[model samples]
Target chain A: MDFSSKLLENAVYEMSQLPGIGKRTALRLVLHLLKQPKEQTERLSNALLNLRSEIKFCENCHNISDVAVCEICANPKRDRSLVCVVEDIRDVMAIENTSQYKGLYHVLGGKISPMEGIGPQDLTIGSLVDKARKGEVKEFIFALSSTMEGDTTNFYIYKQLKGLDINTSTIARGIAVGDELEYADEVTLGRSILNRIPFEGSLKAN
Target chain B: MDFSSKLLENAVYEMSQLPGIGKRTALRLVLHLLKQPKEQTERLSNALLNLRSEIKFCENCHNISDVAVCEICANPKRDRSLVCVVEDIRDVMAIENTSQYKGLYHVLGGKISPMEGIGPQDLTIGSLVDKARKGEVKEFIFALSSTMEGDTTNFYIYKQLKGLDINTSTIARGIAVGDELEYADEVTLGRSILNRIPFEGSLKAN
Candidate 1:
C-alpha cells in the first residue's frame, strides 16, 4: 500500500515486522498511535527501549528478570529440588498462575524446531543439565506443550540428564477438566486411560 | 498475568494499549521482541518515535503527509473543481488505488458519531465549507461509508453548503463487483434497481 507520509510508512513497516501483525493491522495500529496523545507514543517507545536495553535474565533459570536472579528462583519457600522445564517465561507465568506448582522453573527460551532452525543448543538445556549434574535438583518435570517440537526438546533434555540420578516426568496429557469424554482426541484419551491414577488420588487433586 | 521483570511488564502493558491487542498477545509479541536482536527493538522504537514526533499532515486535504501540501493537491492535472469527501487517509488511498477518480480529496479525518462523542465541530467541516465558499469547488462526492454516522456527517456537510451553488452526490450502493444477485441484501438490491444507470453508461464504467 502507498503511504502519504514516510514516517507513517516506516512506523507501519516496523510494526508489521512483529509476529501475527500484517500490513493492514500495522497501519491501523500506527494510525491509532498517531491519534492518541503524544505522551502515549513516548511512553510506549521508552518502555520498549528500556526493556530491551536494561532487561536481564535470571542467572540460574534463564527466565526474564530485573535482577541477577528471578523472584521464583530466589524464593526460599519454592521447591528448589523440583524444577519444571518450560518453553519460555510465559509458561512460567502460566504455571505460577495455577498456584498448584510450588517448584522453581527452567525456561528453555524455545523448543527444538528444526524447521525454524532452532536446535537444542539454541535453548538453555546445557545450563539445566549442568544444574542437574551438580546434584541440586532431585526431580525435573517437562511441562512444555504436546507438539512435536515440545517433545523433541523434552527428549533432548532427558537425554542430557541421563544417569544423573534425577527423577524425570512429563506433565499429564488428557481431556480438559470440563470437557466431555466423547470430544477428547484418540491419543489423549488412550494416554488418559493408560496413565489412570487412583480414584481417591483424583479426588484429592481438586 | 504476572511478569518476572518490571520492564517486561511495562513493555507488555504499553503494547497491549494498541487496538485489538490483549495481554496474552502482548506477552507473546514482547517475548518475540526480547528473543530478537537488540537492534530490532531499537529500530521499532525509533520508527514509532520518529513517526509520532515528526509526522506532518497535508495542509490542503488534511491527509497525513511529510510536506505542507500533499502530492494529489500539488498536482496541477487533478481536477480541483471536483472534490471527493472521505473519512481519512485510508479512504483517500483506497480511492486513489482505484484510479477512477481524478478529482481532489477533502479528508474529514473522521465521521460524525454522537455515540463516540464525535461531532461536526470535531471534524474539518469548517475548512471544507471555507473552501467551498471560495468558489474553488463546483461539485463534491460524499465517499464516506454507508453507516449512520457517515450519512449524518454527509448531511451535516450538505447543510453547511446549502446556500452554495454546488452539486452534491453520494457513492452508489449496490451489490459488490462479482457478487451474485440472489445473495444481495434487500436494501442494496432495491437501491441498485432505483439508481440504475443507462446501459451505455454501465458499459463505459468498465
Candidate 2:
C-alpha cells in the first residue's frame, strides 16, 4: 500500500525513469523484487553497478563492444568498401542480426533535426566525410530512420559529398511512411536493405 | 555493424538482464543512453545505486518504509484490530490507492504452491498467527489470490487458527477467476473487499 520507505520508493522512481514504464509499473517491479530471493536482487544490483564499469564503444564503428574494434569491424571477410550509415549503434545491431549486410558501418550519432536543435556539427559527419575522402569505400549507404529529420540528414550528407567519386544510396521506399526501421520485422528490413536505390545524380553513366 | 568496446558491451548486457528484454532491446537501450546527455545517465545511475541504501521494510507490517514502522502500521487512527493478509506489498499499495480500508495489513511473502516448491513454512505465516494469538485483534482478512496455491495457503492458515476466538475471513469471490488482485481495477477490487464473507466457525461463541 503506502511505500514511505526510501529504498522501495527509490527503486520505483529509478524504474519509472525507463522508457515506456510508468509509476504503477515501477511499483509492480519493486513488489516483484521484494517477493524474489535475495540472490536475484543481489544479481540485479550487481548487474546495474557493473554495467558502466565493463563495457565500451567500438572505436571504429561506435557500436557497443568489449574490445576496441568490435567483431563486425574486425572481420576481414566482410566487405569494407560498402559502408552503411546509421543513426546509432542500435541500427547496427538490427542490420547485423539478419546477416544480410556484410559491409561496414558509420554511426551518425543522430539525424539533423533543427527543431530539436541538433545540427551537422553535433553528428559524426566529419568522420564519414574523411572516410569517404580516403577513396577506399566504393559506396555510402544511408540506413537512417524514415522520419522528416532523417530525410533532412540524408540531403545534408548528400550535399556534403558533391564531388566525391563514391556511390551514394538510401534504403528503398518499400518501407512504409512513418514506420520505424527498428520496429520493422527482420524480413522487411532485410528486403529493404537488399533493394536499395542510388541517389539521383550519383548513378554514373556506364 | 561491429561493436567493440567494453563500456558499450557492459551496458547492453545489463539492459538485457531485465525481464522481457533481449540482446536487441538491450542494444537499443544502450544506444538510447549514448544519445542522451551525460547528466541524464548520471542521474539514472545515482538513483539505481541508492535504491538499496535508501529504504527498507517496515519492522511491524513488512511494507516498504523509510522508518522502523510503515505509515499505515504506525498510524493511531487506523483499525489495529482488523489486519488484512495479502501475498505481497503490491496488494497493500493497490488497497491504499482506493482511500478505503482503514485497517492495517500483513504481507505473507507469497502463497503455498507445491508445484513451485513453495509451502506454508516458506511464507510469513508464523508471525501472522502470533499477531492473532495476542487477543488484541478482532478479525483476520485473507486477501490472497484465488488460485489453487492461494486456496491452499488460506486453508493452511485457517487450520492453524482453529482455536482462536478472532473472526477469520477472506476477500470476496466477486473477483474474477485467474485475476491478480494487484492488476484488478480499483473499483472491482474495492467492491470485493466490501462484500467479504466471514470464515465458518471462526468467531463461534467466544
Candidate 3:
C-alpha cells in the first residue's frame, strides 16, 4: 500500500505494530484521526503518554496505582491477612467486579510460561515468597487459571511457602455457573464430583 | 468495569474512541502497552501526534502529501490533460496500485450523502469544476463507487461540467474479475449485464 505522506505512513506503521491490528485497519484508524478535531488526537496521544510515563504500581501487590500502594492495599476494611494470588491486573479487576472477595490481592503479573520464555523469576513470585515468609498472611488463595503454567506457578509458590507458618489453598475447579452438566468436560466433572461441597454450603450464596 | 488505576482508565477510554474498537479490546491494547518498554509507547504516541499535527496535503489534487503538490500531480510524465476524479486518497492509492493509469487526479474528499448531512459544497466539487472550466483537461474519468451517494455526487459534477468542451465518462460498472456469477449481488449483476462491453473491449485487458 502506498502512502503519499510520510507522517501518515509513520503513524500507520506504529499503529499496525499493536497486536491484532493490520496495515488496513491501522490506515483506517489513522485516517479517522485525521478527520477528527486536532484536540481529540492530542487527547489520545496525551492519555497514552501520560499513562505509560507517569504510571505507578502498588509497592506491595504490584498492581497499577496512582500512589505507592493501591487502594485495595491501603483500605483498612479489606482483609489484609487473606490474599488472592492471580495472573494479572485484569484478573484483579474481574474478581473485584464480583464484590464477593473481600480480601487483598497479589497480582503475579503473569504465569510461568516456558513457551513464552517467562519464568517464575520474571513474575512476582519472589516478592510473594518474601511476604509468605514474613508470616503476615493466614491464607494464600491460588486463583490463576487451571492451565499447566498456572498449576506450575501455583506448585512453585506452594513449595516456597511450605512449612513457613502459612496455609495455602486454590480456587475450586468446576463447570461454570450457567454451564450445562451434560456438556461439562469429563475431567472437570470428575473433579467437581470429588470436591463436592456440602448441600447447605451451596445454598449460602443465594 | 473497575480499573485499579485512573491513568489506565483514561488511556482505555481514549483508545476505545477509534472506530471498530470496543472497551474490552481497548483495555487489552492498553494493558499490552503497559507491559512493553516505555520507548514503544512513546513511539506510538509521538507518531500519532506528529502525524496529526504536521501532516500536509497536495495543493492541486488535495491528496495527502508532504509538499504543496502531490507526486502524481507534479510528475511531468503523468497526463495532465486526463484527470481522474476520485473520492479520497484511498481511491488514489487503489488506482495507483493498478498501474494502468498515468493521469492526474482530483480528490473529492467524500460523496454526497444527505443521510450524513454531506453535500457537494462540503466536498471539493467547486474546485474540480474550476479545473474543468480552465480547459486544461480534455477528459475527466469519474471513478467514484456505484453507491447511491456516489451516483448523486457523479451526476452533480456532470451537471456542473455540462456544455464544457471537455468529455466526461465514468468508470465501468460490472461484476468484478474472478467473481462467481451465481453469487454476485443482483444489482451488480444487473448493471454488468446492462453495461456489457463489446466483445473486443472485454478481451482487451486480459
Candidate 4:
C-alpha cells in the first residue's frame, strides 16, 4: 500500500518484519502507536533495544537469564542428576508452571527442522552431548514436541548418550482435559490407549 | 507466565500493551526476536523511535506528512473548492486509493463518540468550519462513517457552517461490490433501493 509519510512507512515495514504480523496489522499497530504518547513508544523501543543488547543466557542450561547461571540451574534444591531437555526457554517455563517436575532443564534452542534449514548443528546439541559425557547426569528427559523434527532431535540426542549410562525418556501425550473424546486425533487416541497409565497413577493427580 | 530473564519480561510486557496482543503472543514475538540477530531488533527499535519523534502531519488536511503541507493539499490540480471531510488520515488514504474523488480532504481526526468521550471540539472540526466560513469552499462532502458518531460529527460541522452558501452531501451507502443480495441487511437494502442511481451512471464505472 502507498504511504503518505516515509516515516510511517518505515515504521510499518520494520513492524511487519516480525513473525505473524502482516502489512495491514503492522500499519494498524504503527497508527495506534502514533496516537499514543511519545513516552509510550520510547518505553517500548528502549525495552526492545535493551533486551537485545544486554540479554544473557544461563551458562549451564542455555536458558535465558540475567546472570551467568539461571535461577533454576543455580538452585541447590533442583535435581542436578535429572535434566529435562526442551526446545526453548518457553518450554522450561511451561514445565516449571506444572509444579510436578523437580529436575533442571537443558534448552535446545530449537528442534531439528531441515525444512526450515535448521539442523541438529544449528542448535546446542553438541553441548548437550558434552554434558551427557560428563557423567553428571543419570537421566535425560526428552520434553520436546511430538512433531517429526522434535522426534529427530530427541533421537539424535539419545544416540549421543548411548555410550554413556544415562537413561532417556519423553513426556507423555494424550487428549487434553475438558476435550471431547471424539475430537481427539487417531494417533493420539491410539497412543493414549497403548501407553495407558495405571488407574491408581491417574488417581494420584487429583 | 514467569520469565527467567527480566529483559525478556520487560520487552514482552511492553509488546503486550499494544492493542490485540496478549501475553502469550507477546512472549512468542519476544522469543522470536531473541532468536534473530541483534541487528534486526535494533533496526525495529530505531524505526519506531524515529517515527514517533520525527513524524509530521499536514497543516491543512491533518493527514500524516513529511512536510508542512500534505501532497494532496500542495498539489494545484486538486479541486480545492470541494472538500471531503473525513474521520482520520486512514480515510484519506482509503479515498485516495479509489482514485474517483479529485477533491481535497479535511481530516477530523475522529468522530463524535460520546461513549469514548470524544466530541467535535476534540477534533479538527473548527478548522473545517473556519475553511467553510472563508467562502472559498463551494462544497463540503461529509465522507465520515455511517455510524451514529460519524453522523453526529457531520451534523455538528454542518451546523457550524450554517449561512455559508455551500452544498453539503455524503457518500452513498449500498451493498458492497460482488456481495450477495441475500446477505444484504434490511436497512442497507432499503437505502440502496431508495437512493438507486440511474442505469447509465452505474454503467459508467465499467
Question: Which pairs in model 1 have colliding backbones?
Answer: none
Q: Per-residue lDDT of B32-140 in model 3, one digit per residue for the tens?
A: 9999999999999999999888888788898888788888898999999999999888999999999989999999989999999997899998999899989999999
lDDT of 2 by residue, A44-136 (tens): 555544555555666777665677787888999989999999987668867887777899999888899888899999988998888899998
lDDT per residue, candidate 4, A22-112, as tens digits? 9989989999999899999999999999999898989899999989999999899999999999989889989899899998999999999
Give the per-residue lDDT digits (tens) of candidate 1, residues B1-206. Answer: 78888999999999999999999999889989988999999999999999998888788889998888988899999999999999998999899899899999999989999898998898999999999999989999999999999988999999999989999999999889999999999999999999998888888887
Candidates sorted by TM-score, best first: 1, 4, 3, 2
lDDT of 2 by residue, B40-141 (tens): 566566655555455567777776677878888989999999999998777887888878689999888789988879888888889888988889889989
Q: Which one is best on lDDT?
A: 1
Cα deviation at B75, candidate 1, in Å, is 0.9
Give each prediction's DockQ, rounded to 2 decimals.
0.90, 0.34, 0.89, 0.89
Docking class of 1: high
Q: In model 2, which regions exceed 4 Å deviation?
A: A37-56, A75-78, A172-206, B1-10, B42-46, B53-55, B173-206
Clashes of each: 0, 21, 0, 0
Cα error of candidate 3 at position A115, Å: 1.0
lDDT of model 3 at position B98: 93
Candidate 2 CAPRI assessment class = acceptable
Q: List clashing residue pairs in candidate 3.
A: none
Q: Give residue B169's error in model 4 in angstroms.
A: 0.7
Per-residue lDDT of candidate 4, residues B1-206 (tens digit): 89998999999999999999999999999889988999999999999999998888798888889888999999999998999998777788888898898989988888899899887788988888788888888998999889888888888888888888989999999998999999999999999999999998999886
Give the top-scoring candidate (DockQ): 1
